[model samples]
Target: MVRILQGLAHKYFSDEEAIILLLLLVVGTGFIIFFGAMLAPAIASVIIAFILQGLVAKLRSLGVPEIVAILGVFLVFMGILVGFIFGLLPLIWTQVSALASEAPRIIRELQSYLELLPDQYPHLVSAEAVNTVYQQVSAEVGQITQWLVSFSLSSIPDLVALLIYVVLVPILVFFFLKDRRVLISSIGRLLPPQRPMMARIWHEVNLQCANYVRGKAVEILIVGSVTYVAFKLLGMPYAALLAMLVGLSVVIPYIGAAVVTIPVAVIGLFAFGWGTHFIWVMVAYGIIQALDGNVLVPILFSEVNNLHPVAIIVAVLFFGGIWGMWGVFFAIPLATMLKAVFAAWPVKTLERSPASEEE
Candidate 1:
């Protein structure tokens, strides 16, 4: 056993392990820097806007004229953006306003509930303490609203930057699509002769990313459609807006679905009143999750890059902490890339062979 342990350690440390470790370290460092660079909202927006360009490129390859595809996709995306702003925004605003109007009533109900709690446990009762808590909570809420307004005002520069991205993304995406073949050939030529393996790995990674992108699009559509119908049936105000939010939230791993449900259900309960309708909405969401997990996910999301659910969740949390919404948006793609890289490594491949794979 001692000799076997020594042999194993020596094999890992002295053989290709050292090189692989170094490559992984370098890749991690580069990713950290790349994320930091994407902190610029313009950069982030441009990157997202390129998704449309990607769709255009796909259409062009399918026999549509390049210019026509680009124009069509661009216009469709812009129209949707405009529709959301003009149509959905007002409904969302009105519903939100209604919720705000009900805040005092909810507060009073909550205080009554608290009073009941203290009355049940006389030892915990303190009239002054309860008043202080109520006052402090009210004051904190006012400050939060003020902060939100200030923050909104401060985002003017970011909005302007996003406009620049809207103009630039298409230009960049067009060039990227036009030169994609050239880029791949150039990259292939640059691969070191000793590493003929890298070309195959690159091809595999490309295939994996393509599958993931297509699957994700389907997932988003299914989620959005289901959410919209559910919200509408519930008689919830701003159903479209909530549906859009729920659909988009699915992009984030783990808690996204539940996170979206909170606001929708809370508003439904308060604005529309908590009763059969609210419960049915909850039931609908639960049914949706059951369908997603059993039916939808299996059918649409079957092309996973072999990443564990935990790894994807961790990536979402890590990136979301650093870059907030944008990080969460790109988490799956980045995680897929990491999985591809790991899969391409010789040690990982060998470790998953036959007996080792079973272990």
Candidate 2:
């Protein structure tokens, strides 16, 4: 057992640089695990700044001064932020309140439909099964209602935190963008000057993550706008809310789309019933998703390394479990970072067997 342990250690961590890199990763993960919530504003600021950096760079490349570029990007960001707060949010909120007020009616209608299932398919569905399913759904809806009540009652602290983020995030992001070089140099100074493996891993992770985040931002905007237009044209109720869900659903790959479909179907059924209008809504949604997956994704993410579906699902589950929504949004990039680290990680070569060497 001792020899096995020694061999394993030697094979994996023989390099001093590897040990240092591993320690850095461990410390970073531990910090996020313990203090991530407290530093969420800063983390969010960093991510926002990182995404905007590409635009800044593009402006600079077009012969704009650095300060001008920074100001331009920051102003556009602030404009969008303000517009969302003053315009889009109120619309979504109104829809949400309406939905809440209508929930009981929706549920009763759903129950009525469920109750007919046994009669409609007497041989396939029994009244007992329908009752059991309805009971479970009712319990789940009851829990959701309780949660909404509690959340509303406890939203004071959250609102305060949000205000702080609203004030602080823009400031942090501006400084992060303006002092990007200084910050990079300062962080660089803390690490060993000779860090080939670290450099390699950083290069890979940075390219992949940056591309992913920016592409996703664009994807969300395009998908959401397109969905809103389609829903509005179809006279769908809560068009903005459903459009937002459809947009954000791309973040979780397969799972998000499936989950968001429930709400879309429910809202459509409530508004248009089980008729051609409802069918049209579903058809439009299907076309949008198909275009996004086949056309938009290929163009936007041509540079990204594709993980296996199983690996992607596992990453989504693992990271989403740990960090909730943020984890779910960043699962792919996190997984990519892990992949890059493993690819560049230093390891000692083991001795080849004499029989294999002869062959």
Candidate 3:
């Protein structure tokens, strides 16, 4: 046991930097897990600042001065935030509330369809099975309604939090951008000076995460706008809400597309019925999804290189379960960071020779 412990110690604790890295990882993860909610605004600010750094770099590449580029990016961020708050959020909220209110009628329509299963396809589907499904659907609808009601009831507190986030995030983001070097230097001062592994991981993660976040933002806007336009042309009900779901669906892997499809199909069926219009609506939606997954995602996230789909999905589920929406949003980057760390971690290699074996 002493020999084994000695071997383990030699493998992991041979270097002071390794000890420091391990300590930092444990402490950082603990802070994130324990006080994440309390630090959400700050965390969110960091993410937003990272995203906007791409724009700053772009402006700098175009011969813009450093301060000018930062100012431009900051102004653009503020404009977008203001627009989202005043123009987009209210519309999305109204649509969401409307969707919740219409749930009962939608459930009724689904139940009505289920009722015909026994008569229409008696051999294929039994009344008992149909009724079972009907019960499940009804229960799900009730749960959804309950959640919406609870959410509405708590809107005041939520709004207050939102207001706080709105005021704090921008300030934090501005300072984060303006003093990026100073902040980085401050953080570095706390870490062991000789940290090749940590530095390598940080460099890779920073590059990948900045590209991923900025690309995701662009993808979301493009997808949402395109979907909204198409839905509007088709006269689809709740176009804005459905488009928003379609846009955000890009965050999760296959699961998001599958889940969002439920509402889109439901709304489409309710709006257009089983007609050519409904068929067209579905085709259009399918096209949007196909383009996003096959074309847009690849083009935008090419900088992410070769993240396995399974890894991405697992990250989405695991981190999302732990930290909810923020986790889901950062899942890919976090997974990438983990992968980089694992790759960068120094592993002890044993030289197996006759002399060593004899010893």
Local distance difference test, per candidate?
A: 0.67, 0.91, 0.87
> What's the lDDT for candidate 2?
0.91
Winner of 1 and 3 under lDDT: 3
The runs of at least 3 residues in candidate 3 whose Cα sits more than 4 Å from the true structure, single-residue gaps closed, are 1-15, 146-153, 356-359
Q: Pick the candidate with the highest lDDT.
A: 2
TM-score attained by model 1: 0.73
Those runs of model 1 whose alpha carbons end farther than 4 Å from true positions after fitting are 1-75, 82-102, 113-143, 185-195, 348-359
Candidate 1: worst-modelled 10 consecutive residues by lDDT:
344-353
Taking the tens digit of each residue's C-alpha lDDT, what string does model 1 give over 83-162?
76677777776655555556677667656655666667767877777778878867876675565557558889977876
lDDT of 1: 0.67
For 200-225, candidate 3 gives per-residue lDDT tens digits of 77787777777777888998899999
Top model by TM-score, which number? 2
Across 1-359, the per-residue lDDT of candidate 2 in tens digits comes to 99899888899899878899899999999999899999999999999999999899999999999999999999999999999989999999888877777778888898899999989999999999988988887788777777676776789899899899999999999999999999999999999999887888888888888888888899999999999999999999999999999999998788888999999999999889999999999999999999999999999999988778898899999999999988998898788778878877878988879999999
Model 2 quality (TM-score): 0.94
